[model samples]
Target chain A: GSYTTSSQQPSKLLFRQLFEKESATYTYLLADASHPEKLALLVDPVDKTVDRDLALVKDLGLKLIYAINTHVHADHVTGTGLIKTKVPGVKSIISKASDAKADLVVEPGDKICFGDLFLEVRATPGHTLGCVTYVTGDGPSQPQPRMAFTGDALLIRGCGRTDFQGGSSQQLYKSVHSQIFTLPKDTLVYPAHDYKGFTVSTVGEEMLFNARLTKDEEAFKNIMANLNLSYPKMMDVAVPANMVCGLQEVESKPC
Target chain B: GSYTTSSQQPSKLLFRQLFEKESATYTYLLADASHPEKLALLVDPVDKTVDRDLALVKDLGLKLIYAINTHVHADHVTGTGLIKTKVPGVKSIISKASDAKADLVVEPGDKICFGDLFLEVRATPGHTLGCVTYVTGDGPSQPQPRMAFTGDALLIRGCGRTDFQGGSSQQLYKSVHSQIFTLPKDTLVYPAHDYKGFTVSTVGEEMLFNARLTKDEEAFKNIMANLNLSYPKMMDVAVPANMVCGLQEVESKPC
Candidate 1:
């Protein structure tokens, strides 16, 4: 199916999962290992932790190529805009359906490639209509099982609230069952955020243990109705700031 | 040379990194993938998170053979005893010199094995006199570079204080350079705890960037001396509770 040669492939893939405690967001840094260029990309970076992420990138000698967000977050403004401002050629990417401003807009099935490694995008809405999951390739030849970057659609033993942001409990259930649960049992699940300290989970584990997802749709809807979660504190400012690429607000400040 | 045949080898090694937010401690779960027996081990679990960690181990269908502590911690009590209370035949491990009671005592060059994977214990005693670093094997045939579980001896861009519990800056410097730093440059470093959001680093990165360990012996001693760090709030309770293995304190309390 592919024509790439062995020498052209990287010996390893550099992966790091970083946390932003205030919003409990998880940001991901991915790059190809042993390549001279050290091309890298980030997913779901938060505005508050740009400095720390940038320093890490510099320390690893990785070249920034893209800053991608799975959705426009209500919890925190994204750092893509700040990253672009700091790194001359970096591009910001978001799902076109989100109606957010980004340098490049992607749709489902699009391949986000960094050297030989690529994340296949899958549209998994209901947490937010534009939500997408980035999945790695899987096969006997792949170094590791597929990893699902399930923004807010999935969490460890939990799922994102479908009470706001065009959220529909029914739609979320459908999306997860169709797009994510079908992955290989061992596929690692990395979410966009976590309130609990869990860092990762597997598709098999979640299929068996995910609280709301395991219930029937009606029960899940009932649970969602009664969740009684207060409106997110950052939603008012973060949503607007995030829609325009998360940089203008930071730049708008005199500092 | 390994006499083990291909049929006996596991398809993959199951690894999970769990976090405890209160203390910023990271607990590790490791097992051989696809083995019917599913024997597993945990490293550096915290007292506050025994329930959460136990639930996960059960969810993963892993048999807990050992609950190993890299050292008796001052900031928080270890969870080995509570784990033992819940799971039968689980051994609690610590360094023999730590002066804390554990079911099994380890010395340098000790091999802690589960299935085909094993961690080579190397005594690295600078943060505390009894501190040890557990390193995985590395070579052309290994799946990944060695992983050093450097319990407080090293953290990301920092090292533990040498202000108490047989602390010595010069001794720490000697232990690190002679034991940990001598490992392969690419060996991944997994510390017992981290204040910052970083979860892992490499021996090479820490060698160049570790704030305390990178300094010359004299300079390192000066930094450790002037830290002015406050006495650990939980030291009085945690240290004593940890000495007899962490479960007795919990048993002493009632509903």
Candidate 2:
């Protein structure tokens, strides 16, 4: 009904970036304030910080509809299962490639909708086999701000290493070039983890400046294959817990 | 075998203070390097940082003989259970009053030993019902240095809040004056948590300058009773997990 861009209209949509200091993980909360119900969605919720996130949701008077993960993470345990436990009926969503039990297993080209807003899913599996980027729809307005939740595929100045759990430097390069960089140069890139305090970056900035990912395909693969990074500290415990969508092994068993 | 004081003989003993930034928690590692076995013990291990701790233990080539908690913590999950899963035969020790299942239930006057070094347990409840201070024994050398692991019962220039989990102002005051303040003025005090980047303090400094605990008994009680602090963010999860000595609920029981 209105020609004004919703991105500029703060009252129409709600968005927040929450950080978990322990793991340097960023959790994004997006809600459609335009809707009467204020339907909301959360991305990459850390288990230990659920109390803070939930309190925030209450304070903002938003009703969370989905808790989504870009992939099964290794650095920190997800709060997806715990959030579901806390707010009954909130859907748990993840990529089908993850093969983890989730309420909704989304694939490439899938659209997750809330009220009038939708996020177009684009599989960007370089960091992990199941990694995906959620791109916001431009809506009816021509100048609406487009955001890409890049997960670990494309970091601010670097990209996720292609050494863990089905990681492939070639595939990651293709995904970034084809799926993410193809978007508008002004599109904002938000990664799942940032250790050096960076919060957000734009596609054009990464395209010209991302030290690791912007290189030619052959060079990028060589860098990722030989970086020889150490295993993440929480990998042993976080992986198993994240596979079941962050449920403790005991909690997932039949009662 | 030698007349040199233990503190002066640095090669005979190894001590390190590890910090968990999220909680500002300090985990101390003390080893009796004089022993042929290179026996080591960790105090206040945090769950998320277990891998880091274990890596350090491996790097030092020390045999981890015990993992002890200052008390059941509310800020972070203790790594006691996780450490047990990683290293077998390492005893888990805690105060008997904590009622948490541990490999060893220690009381006042009891000692935990690693090679020739020993920690003399001193009951110092009030921060929590089961808080205890572990005072190191002085060796044969007169005027040998002694250290007290005071946990939350005494901080560098402050003390823990006496408002939750059976906390008491009067008992905290009495415990500090009778149990901790009575230690030799030169005795070093290592607290379980320090926010101001302080690594160590002496009993004399705290006795004269500890703003909260240095006051007269009645005045100390008044300060603690009116602090009115917010509940810890991790209390709900940490309390239950710590009760079973850091065992995840699922691992402890049948479904």
Worst 10 residues of 1 chain B by lDDT: B1-10
DockQ values per model: 0.32, 0.01
Clashing pairs in 1: B126-B172
Error of 2 at A205 (Å): 0.8
Q: How close is candidate 1 to the true structure, as a TM-score?
A: 0.92
Lowest lDDT block of 10, candidate 2 chain B: B1-10
Candidate 1: chain B TM-score against the reference chain B: 0.91
The local distance difference test score of each candidate is 0.81, 0.78
Candidate 1: which stretches are off by over 4 Å? A1-11, A138-143, A249-255, B1-11, B138-143, B249-255
Summarize candidate 2's per-residue lDDT along A1-255 as a digit string, tens digits: 010011232224456666677787889888776577878899999998888778656655688999999999999999998998899889889999977778898999999987777788999987899999998887652114577899999987788888887888999999999999898876778789776534566787678768887799999888888887998999999998888888775454410
Backbone steric clashes in candidate 2, count: 0
Give per-residue lDDT, candidate 1, residue B86.
88
Candidate 1 lDDT by residue in tens digits, A1-255: 010000111235677889998898999998765456778899999988999999988888888899999998999989988888898999888998888888888999998877667788999998998899998765543335567899999988898988888888888889999999998776778999888788888888888899889998899888878999999999999998788778664453321
Candidate 2 lDDT, B151-198, residue by residue in tens: 999997799887887788888899999998898776777898876534
- What is the alpha-carbon lDDT of model 1 when measured against the actual structure? 0.81
TM-score of chain B of each: 0.91, 0.92
